[model samples]
Every structure is written in C-alpha cells, then in structure tokens.
Target: MTAMRHYWLATAAKTGAVLADLPGLSVPKVKKVIGRYEPATASFPLVGKGVPVDWERILIEGATVFHLLRDNPNDPAHGIPVWGGMLVRPPRTEADDVQLSLQTAEWYFDGRYVGDKKYTGVGQNLIVKDLVESFAAAGPNGGLPIRVEIVNGGDGKPRDREYQNSDDKTLYSVLQELMGVIDGPEWTIGWEWQANPERITPVLYVGDRIGTAKPAWMPSPAAVFEMPGSVLSFTDDRSYGRGKGANVVMAKSSGQGGARPESTPMVAVDDLRPTFEYRFTPSTSIKDVGTLDEHAQAKLQILKDGSPTLEMVALADRGPLLDVDWFIGDDIGYSIGKSSRSRRQPAAIQVDPEGYAPASPVDGEGYGSMAGLTLDTDNYAEPAPDTRPIVPAYPRGREGVARVIGWELEPQGTPTVTPILYAPE
Candidate 1:
C-alpha cells in the first residue's frame, strides 16, 4: 500500500537551543513527500579531543551507519556544524507506525585475521572492490556498483600493533575518528540508488566533468524546520542496539615500520564500547599524548574547520537544512517493456495473491496497470500491405472503455475489426 505518512529520524545535542522541537520532527502536510515507506535519518557525530559526552548510545539509537559531512553552508568565521547519513525504505510495520532503522549504504565483512575474533585484521577501510564482491552474493541488484563519493575524507591509518574490537565496524565510523586532511576542513558525501538498485548518474560539483542533473523519482521537500519530532519512531530491535554500532574494529599492525618488528601480533588496544579510551597519532611526536575520549574524537571530527575544538561541538551546525530539491524537473520518459529491463510484455493474466477488493478511488492505488489485445491481432501485430487504422465511435460519455465485440476475416485474408462496444468504467 502507498504510504500516506512521513517523518525524519534525526538527533542533536539534547542541551542545544537550536534544535529545540527535536527527536520526532513531523513532516509538513506537503504533497512532495518521499514515496513508499522510506526511512529518513540525520545524525551528529561525537568526535575530536575534549571531555567525553556519552554519545555512543546516540550512535546506536540513531542511524546505524552515517556519512560524516563537513558542511559550512554559511561559511562564517564560526563554522556551521552539519553531519549527513543514509536511509532506506523500511519494511511494513506491524502497526500503523514507521520504523527508521537505517543501515549504512556501505557493508562490512567480519572474519578471523590474527588474534581472536575481536582482533579481526579488518581495519576501518575495507576495499570497495572487495565489499561489492561480498555484498553481491546476497541478491541480484545488490551487486550493482554504487558510486560512493568519499570527498575530503582522511585515510584510515593502521596503528603500530594488533588491535581488538568488541564488534565489527563500518568504514565510515572508522574514518570519522580522524579529521580530514586532504579536502579539509569540510566536504559533503551525497549518494543515491541505495534503495532502488538502479544506477544514478554521478554529479560533479566543481570538476570539468560536471554534467546535467539526474531525474529524481522521489518527491522533493518544500522546507525544513529545526523543530522537534524529527525522530518520530524507534525500533526495539536490540540486535542493532548499543553493541551494534560499528561492524569491524581496526586491529594493530603485527609489526612496526622498522627497528622494533615484533615476532607475533602486537596487542595495541582493547575493545571499544559505549566509552573507550584512545591515543591518536599524526606521528608519534604528534600523538594525543594522553588518553583520549572516543566521544570527544567524534565531536572534533565534526567541529568547524579551524574552529575544531571540544567546546564548539555543543554549538555546531544542527541540521541538514532538510530541504528537498530546489525544483522538480519535467518528466523524460524512460524505456519499459521490450527495450529496458530485458523483459517483454506478458500475454498472460496476473492475479494478486490477495483478492481484488479495491478501495475507493479517493484512497487511490487500487490496481496495477493492465494491458489488453485487439480482436484482429494480425492487423495490429503484423499489418498486411493494405491494413489501415480505424476508430470506433459510440455514445459520448464522461467515462467509458471500448472493447472488441467481433472480428471479420476470411481464412486467407487479413483480419479486420467488425463490431465494438463501449462500457462505463
């Protein structure tokens, strides 16, 4: 059934004055809502150096996977804080409510590497090629290559020793630990076709390869408010609960670069839970020096460029602006039937497993599209040299459909239309 309801599942600094009406932000009574039961998710990562706020719980309660975007739309001396993530169409709920359980568009693989299961040699960054390979085994469209744009994101560095993880983690969660040094201090990651496996043309914001925009099938939003109720519903699924934050944790290197090459895997650190201590390094000399708060590291990753600090995390940009496409473009017909999808129109009938009991037209979407054949199939299918087009006339009515009543054709001659009838819809 077509969904008549919508919502945005988002999170923010609970103490912030900006996103006051938060948690379950309601979708305006606008017509341009996303089609189907799709989940919309937003998040604020808790990163960088500072006093730790218990944000690990937030990571679990919110979107399962997220893209850490550095947005300063209003690039002022003080930067605006913005973090973006991914969402998919949720399955039908048992009740009338919607579920916003968001999984990252990127998938992860877990296995034994060096030590126990926790020290699963898997690092923050999994090869895109390998990821698509493993994911394709699940389904047909699942293997399709989705263009994942990792703009301005820092490389995931492997530390000097073997590490252990309580659980596997997503690459996004891993890179969110370090601030961007390549495109720094801000950039955005936008992707499509996660729900619909069809490939979406990529957009080039600045490069010479900039092409025209793609036709967006989903309804665009009108306005985005910072009021509450954005995160309207939550799932009680404990599997993806606090313990299900990131899938893989990066294990330490078996040996250092030179002199102190260890014979066995070096145990760098222990498992990270809702709260874990860390020691980050650009180089040994530039290490965090003391124990670091995992939450604080996330807060710093999202802090404005030069304004990256723990205190600023509380006042960071609290939104995605939540606006839809600026304007809807005209429809450009796409191929169906014989050309695209490599399938032909069926000559057989289709029946719904559930008996056809259509709701009122007001409720809409009561039937699937139907196709029919003419009585004189040869004239329409493979017209003879003298075949001509014909139009049947009947009493004018507000609504009616023409149906074949009979056909006229000799055993050796071309078929022709004989009688036609019109009936009200």
Candidate 2:
C-alpha cells in the first residue's frame, strides 16, 4: 500500500484559492503550496476560527488552486492538466461556506451583448473557446485537456446597447452575473471535463457533500455502495470549532499594464437569438460628441423581451437622410419589417426614426476602395482556394478578437492572431 503523492488539478495563479490539504503545515510548507498557481497573495489563507477539540483548527481562506500537472514538480509551471477547475465548495456544503466555483475552459455562448462583446469586440462564445484552446497551447501541457463543452447561457436581455464607450460594464462582470443566473435544479453545471468520457456527472447525495463530483481512483459505486449518487466526504483536518462557508470571487482585469487585458472583444446582438444569418457592422460612429465608435455598428433590428412597439422600438437615425437597409441593398432583403427597423406588426404608436449611421463612416478610410474596401468586411470577402482562402462565416475584426481575449488585471496574457482565422478549421 502506498500513499498517493499529492498534486493539484490546475493552477490558481490566474485566480487565488484556499489550500485545505494539510492545515498544520507551516509558513515554508504553505509557501510551497501557494507558489503552486499564483505568484503573490498579499492577503491569502485568511485564517479565522473557533475550532473544537485539541487546538483551535485553522482555515486557509483562499481559492482552491489547480494547474497543469507537471512531470517535474520543481518547475511545475511547464506541466498542464487535462481538466482542472475548483469546486470552491462541494454541493450542499455547510451554511458557512459560499461557493465560488470555476467551470471548465471549454465554453459555449449565445445571445446579444453590448456589441456582442465577451471582452471588447469579440463575441463571448469566441473568447471562451479561445481560452480553452490556449490551455491546450501551453508550452508543455498543450492541447485540450479533453474535449468538453463550456456552456454559457447568457441573459436574453442586453441593456448596454453600445460598445460605444471604453467605460462600459465589463465582460468579466457579465460572465459572473451569467453564472449566478443559472437557477439549478441542475446545480452542477455541464459536466466538469474529465479525461474519461464514460464517466457521467455523479450525483452528490446529502450529508457531508464531500470530495469531487467523482475522483478517478474512486471505487466503483456498485461494488461498495448501493446508491450510485451518494458518498460521504472527507476534508483535510483544518477542522474548526465554528465552521464558515466558502464565498469565492473570480478575478477582475488586472491593471498592471503587463497584466491588463491585451485587447477587448465580445459580440452584441441587436436582437435576442440572432434572427438573421447575416450580421452587419455595428454603429461605429465618430461624431465628436457622438457614439458611433461606441456603437458596434451592427445595426438595431431587435426589441426588448415583451415590449409594445411603442414601449421600446428600434428606429433609424433621425438625421436628415434616410437610413439604409444594407441587408436589402445587398439583396439580403428584409426579414419582414413593416418599417426599416421593426418586422413585428407595426402600430401607429410606434415610431421609426430617421437618418442612419452610414455603413460607410463619416470618415474616408471606410471608402478606401483601392488598398481595398475596408467597409463592411463583416458581410463580404474574396473567393478562396488561391492566395486567400474563402471565408463564409460573419467576420469579427482583429480589434474584436483582441477585445474578447483581453483578461482583466493580468498582463501575462498572450496576444491573439491578427484578422483572426475564421473559425480555426
């Protein structure tokens, strides 16, 4: 019989976590532990307690750290994990701890946002995919830990219609909020990515609510147990007199220029659940006091959840000239709007405004047809199989991809491809 040597599933350096394995371990031992993920934790293993028995047990207040499993522990950074995310707190834990969990990097996103931004200009779905792929791309432990679906059920209603300003609510906050919204009869989100696919998301029975969803070495339930979903859990001896709950907060964008987001990108939908297969440029305006730059320039064809046409209507610019329906001009045609804005049955009370954010900006670069027509790249591209490959999906420019990959508060983030390769085939 051998004691299983200890190891973490992933790195917490990106975001700090609490170490619960061996509480009595001293400063040196703890430092060895903390060094596992992040570089610094000025405020970590925040301890406070009222433990019973022999001595007051200690509680290390920090995130549960995970990182790629290294072949060499001395320089563990080189190694990576196939799948590692903190549970923060197991299902149905004591009332004291709050669960600040992290899902797998593989993710799926749908829904409109302020310019459909998950970051600055990239769509949320794209960003999440990039992240998962990045882990697969680390120097040593590269490649997806395993193929897992990262699911994001974004809010159907988008409040901030403009990517118009650099100072809008952040994508990090939106993602955090998104997780909070999934009311769970299904608390355990899409299965934690495991190296093994045959393993189903296990059921955590009541009581201790311990261990992981399922640990690999775990004995087959049928052999030693009856209920497939139940298991008594055990935790490190950091036992205390009065137990506290776990409430973890995901990290925000780090401002250290080195740590700041390299770029901002995310997508926005003027309408919920993209209605049209084709998407145009957002309203990227440049009026000095204007909001066109803030506008994703994609156009506004959507309405609120259940508003009367008059309650909240998508109208054309009230400017002197008429707003252009690029969708129709290109022969893409309208979806059935009585007016240029709304396809919903229009009413006398509803008013469609005038003027438009020209598909071509007030500026001249948009009209540069020689070095090339930079205008509306989203809707157009050249034929492929030659110097350039054919791209059929809607395009999101470099800025948009950068926007999506940008992480807050961490400058160590890597840069992305310019003019992103459409859907990395």
Candidate 3:
C-alpha cells in the first residue's frame, strides 16, 4: 500500500481505538519473537535481586473519528475474522517548521480550512495551538521535534523568497479569515518583538520534573487598581497617670508639633509602629509549581505515582509596604513589631558608699545623693603623698564601657536564632 494509504489506515485505527476506549496493540512488542523476548534491565532496582518493570496507564480518552462495527456471523468474510491496527506517528516539534507546513498546506489547498478555526488559518494560530496542546500532553519537560523546509511555489525560487519576506502578510491574511469566522481579538504575530533571547529558553523536563520557564502565555490585566485592603495600618498609644487632678501630664505627638507653653512641664516622647500583612486569594485551583532546586530529581519520584499537587501564594508590594496572602486559607491578620531608638534607655552604673568612713584617709570615696550611691565628702580629694609612690603608670589603665546593645529570643526547642536591636548610646 502507498504511504498515503498507510497513513489513512493508521489514522482510522487510532480513531477506532479511541472510540472503543482501548489501548492500541504494541507493534514493537508484537514484532519480537515470543521465545526470545527478554525484559530490559532497570536503571534502578525496585527490590533487592530483581529488575523493575515499568508500565504506562493507557489513555483511552481523546477525540475519535470512528466507531466500532459489528460483523454478521453468517457472512464468509466475517467468519474469517478482521483485525485492525493504528499507525502512530511521533509528535511534531520545531515551531517554525510546523508553522511552515501549515502555511504550505493552506496554500496548496487554496484556502480550504482543514482544522479548527481557533487552531488553524492566519497567524499560524492553528499551528501554535497544536504545538501548545502537544507540549502540554507530553508533560512540561518533554521536547517535541519540529521541522521547517523550503517549499517550491509555482512562481519559482524568487516567489519562495518573496513568501519568506512577506510571511507576516500571509499570516495576517489568514488571521483576518479566522477572525471573521471566530470571536476574539485579532491574533498578533511578530518575531523577536518583545522576547528576550537569553531568557526565551524552553522549559526543561526530566521525567516528571518540569524546568523553569516564564509563563508568557498568561494574559495581563486590563487595568490594575491599587486596592485599599492591600494596605497595612498600625497605631501606638500610651498614657501615664490618672485623668483627674493628675500632677503629671503626658502628651505624645508624631510628625509636627505646636510650641509648648513656658509654664508647662514637658517630657520628650518617642513611639514606633510598623505593620505587615499578606493579601492573597485562598483557593486550591491555582497551582504554583515551585522552581526546581537540588531536590528536583527526588521530587520526580512522587509525580510518577500520581498527578502532582501544588499551592500558590500571591504576594505584592507597593513602595515600602508589602502584602501577601495564601490562596487556600481564611482571611486572617498578622502583626510585626519594630524598635525605635528613642524608646530605649541609656547605659548607667550603680554605686554604693556603705563601707566609706568620713575620717579615713581613703581618697577615692565621696558622699553625695545619687540614685544608688552616696559619696564621702571628707575623703573626696586626692591623697597628698603615698608611702609607696605609685609605680610608673602601666599604660594608664585603659577605660572602657560595655553595655547591652541588643537581645533576641529563639523560640523554645527551635534551632533558629533571632536578634533584637537596642537603641544606640
């Protein structure tokens, strides 16, 4: 049979399999000699001493163009038995080549539409649709082989060059035709228009792990409004002494303040307030397949068992503010606190004079009213002369002051360490 005939037969067989919800017979397996058949070695062993056998779950769901036919037992042809098989072709890759084939097919058919309008026609819409669908079906990491070749136009080589030069024009015409029949915005087509070649690389996949790729196909919002809910607010309030007949009055102001009266006793005040909140929709429908890290290979093992699951958390920032929320959780509020320099106390020392005697010749002793110490006035002055003159000063005792600058609390049983800053002295 001719190649065309064989192709049609294969297409029909595939269609029949789809309609019957059955797996196509494995041609490779059937071609092998039954007695000589040997199972391939497993790259990794499943159990100690045996090779692992892998089986793919047959996909019985797809578009089918044919239905099963029942044969009459009384007919001689029916009694002889009828067998059917489908011809399976490898997937197509190479966007440019696939696009060229589609264009050539349209030109050869004289504008006859073969596939879905949303898929085929102008702008290589059909070709792109096919490529996307194939890519998706093959898994994110799978690659498709696409081909592009120059085709002869009846006008000759020069005509082919013209076609190449005006490829966008041909695409535009096809888009117009498709748009006339379909409902949507006009399809846009261009090359290297806004794409960054360095980052335009395709997503890689090894087994089930899909490599990183920017989702450029996603649609952008018509207009992005800054939502009020996205903003986080914080307030600080402190009051000292009772309201009625209180001798002390405390007033706190932020930003700008008015002049104070001369008779009014005043005290400096400082306060700090900071706010943080996450603003994200809560839903499981949105899946965020995180970037592949060092554990990508190990994670693939889980996907082979079943469909991979994922959760996405939306995050946004405006100026100094940030908002984040989980897509699959109830609305909740969270708080974060910050320290201010003015709120912290300065370093101080506590001294005592309980052992000092006024009549003693000791000179470093002094007596005065202080928070924690009294100085002895009788011995406040330096000694006139010491029986043993002080030995040559050894590097004039270096004076230093050490104070607590910061502190942090690590949650009980946690390995993490956190720092708490202190106001500078």
Q: How high is the CA lDDT of each candidate model? A: 0.23, 0.22, 0.20
Residue-by-residue lDDT tens digits, candidate 3, 1-425: 11100001111111112222222212111111100111111011123432212211111112111111112334422211111211212223543111100111112112122222222123333342333334322333432221221111111111000122222223323323322221211221111101232111111111110111113453321111111222232221122212211222222212223532111222122121122111111111112222111112222222212221111111122211111111101122211221131111212223444432321122211221233334444433332353221212211111111111111111112111111111111
lDDT of 3: 0.20
* Candidate 1 per-residue lDDT over residues 1-425, each given as its tens digit: 22111212223211111111122322211111110111333323223433125433334442223222222345322222212223333334354333434433222211111111221333222222123233322334332233333222222332222223432433233222222222112111223222232222211111111111223453322222111212111111112222222222212212256532112211222122233222223212112221122323332332211120100001011222221211111111111111222222222233344333222122221221222211222322333445332211101101111222111111111111111111111
lDDT of 2 by residue, 1-425 (tens): 22112233322322222222322221111111100111221112223452212211212122233232213344443322222333232333445432333333222111112223334443433443343333322225232222324233332222222232254433323333222211211111121223232121211111111111223354221111101111111111211111111111111233454543221222333222333222222211212211222221211111111111101111112111011211100111111112212112111121113322222232221111122223444433343334321111111110000001110111011211111011100
Query: In each prediction, how many residue pairs overlap at the backbone (N, C-alpha, C within less than 3 A)?
Result: 31, 77, 24
> Would you estimate the TM-scores of all the predictions?
0.23, 0.20, 0.13
Q: Order of candidates by lDDT, top first?
A: 1, 2, 3
Off by over 4 Å in 2: 8-168, 180-425
Worst 10 residues of 1 by lDDT: 308-317
Error of 3 at 363 (Å): 88
Off by over 4 Å in 3: 1-168, 184-199, 202-425
Top candidate on TM-score is 1
Error of 3 at 184 (Å): 4.9
Which model scores highest in lDDT? 1
